[model samples]
Target: MRKKRALAGSGAALALGLAAGYPCLWRHACLTWGATAVEVHREMPGDALLPTAPLVTTRAVTVGAGPAEIWPWLVQMGPGRGGAYTYDWIENLMGLDMHSADRILPEFQDLGLGDTMRLGRNGPVMEVAGLDSGHALVFRSQDGAWVWSFGLYPSRHGTRLVSRNRIQPPDPSPLYRLFSLYVMEPGSLVMERRMLLGIKQRAEEPIAGR
Candidate 1:
């Protein structure tokens, strides 16, 4: 009887701990996954991609390299190119066939407006909608439901890389909106954070012979 009571008490304590921790987890997810006030108000060049998307997410990171160095990585990102620069195993599980490159490839360096970049083997296709060379690149889905943009700005340290995604789900029902807020936001945060950090690491690496 004593052992049973102790086990019950421990289980109750564990449940209480989990219940107490849930709020912190939600708060962290909201702040990290959702756009900040500045990002929400700041006008992004890629805003034209969706024009009026109700859902927007902005994530930024400072890189220790100039915009020129970062531009190459952005331009060459895709399934058949330099890869998404995120977790290859996760992306491969989703059939992206990602193989991130460690060095710049010349053939993939010549991206231009209107070119189609494959996200995964069977994932959505994104067409280049806007290009500002070393400044920004914006891509829009063929259906016009999704727009993703990458911006580079000169900073005191080196460069600030900002990634913004605008998504207008085909179904704007409350259920879909709720799903996006609760599910998509957290998932996107995980993938995007990794991609941004990956870019930062690659951009900061010293160029061979330079």
Candidate 2:
């Protein structure tokens, strides 16, 4: 009975993510896309082989301003809020895209955990968590599909922002590891860089410093 229940649960989980049109199943729906193929890698120094960590990747960007300057951009990111720093041309070309980074609270002070950030046409909503004022913010989705965070620190020039994502396969499918290393990691790299760039541009522009 226990085994049967577990199997049933797994099936339901998979079914839930496999939305129409997209062959791929989303652990947390970001936006519907075609089947994406990714490659996974597990490596460590010489003799010490660190067990494969849950396909995590990190991307970094430098801002000309301070963390306080950069905080608002991240907090404001959402579909209807702040448009994602990503390229508008490319995103629009992709078709039926949603989820802009700018979508967020009107007031920065209101930003906090449990806030639901939505995307286009019922795309997955990332729940805010692990928020540290002007320091860090983490957004997570159900099924452990996405664990994205931003960490800000002082730099000699100005401020450095690092965005990290840790993704876990919703199911024990072989494709999970591959996608983490290849597709998701690369996508994260591209998106995070654009995000930081957008933050930097906005922060450096005119805005009352906090």
Candidate 3:
């Protein structure tokens, strides 16, 4: 029975490795949620709006690659493509459909100052207010509640990636405030950690355009 259990565990690990990509590290690196404040719960898209909060958590990761390499992964992020790379399994378990990156097609047409860069099946749905190629990009919902930014910098080893999300305090509601502090903030921390690791693995890999 013990031997059978060990084999089962090994089979599960192998399956995960295949799902992530060719190399094992790509998936393994993302599984570890470092120093997270709260355990994560998965939910489908349109499940429910995030509980309103006063402030959002921000996190950073240093990758062993260049900014050029990391930028593609960020700008082309979505449900199918690279994904937010935050809490993927949680998103999947929640019945939210997981997406693949191969469907991405980013063309540099009509890119202008203050013009929101748009892509994916839904055009301009996700907007980044502050965008600078190879440096930083900020994503915010116009008139919506959540805002996030991705920053990159040259590092001794490669580059540094920073992700920040801002949660606006909701209308007068005590329950909303409480959920933000106890649930959302902690989940954000966990997701941010995973996001960085995912980028790191992809950026460091020996791929074209990196």
Using TM-score, give the best candidate's number.
Answer: 1
Model 2 vs. true fold: TM: 0.61
Q: Model 3 segments beyond 4 Å from truth? A: 1-53, 93-96, 100-125, 207-210
Q: Write the per-residue lDDT of candidate 1 for residues 89-173, one digit (tens) a residue.
A: 9888988878999888899999988999666766688999999999999999888889999888787989888888888887879
Over 10-110, each residue of candidate 2 has an lDDT whose tens digit, in order, gives 99887655433223433322221111122112221111211233555555656778887788778776655566677755555554253454323465447
Tens-digit lDDT track for model 3 on 1-210? 999999999999997666445225432233323312221122212112334534545456778878887787777675544566666678676544444343234752223334443333443344556667777676655555766666676768677676655556655598886665455555656767766787777777755453
Residue 198: error of model 3 in Å?
0.5
Q: Deviation in angstroms for 142 in model 2?
A: 2.7
lDDT of each structure? 0.82, 0.59, 0.57
Q: Please give the RMSD to the true structure for each candidate, in Å.
A: 3.9, 14.0, 11.5
| Candidate number with greatest lDDT | 1
TM-score for all predictions?
A: 0.82, 0.61, 0.60
- Which pairs of residues collide in candidate 3? 80-99, 80-100, 81-101
Q: Which ranges in model 1 have alpha carbons more than 4 Å from their true place?
A: 1-40, 207-210
CA displacement after TM-score superposition, residue 208 of candidate 3 (Å): 12
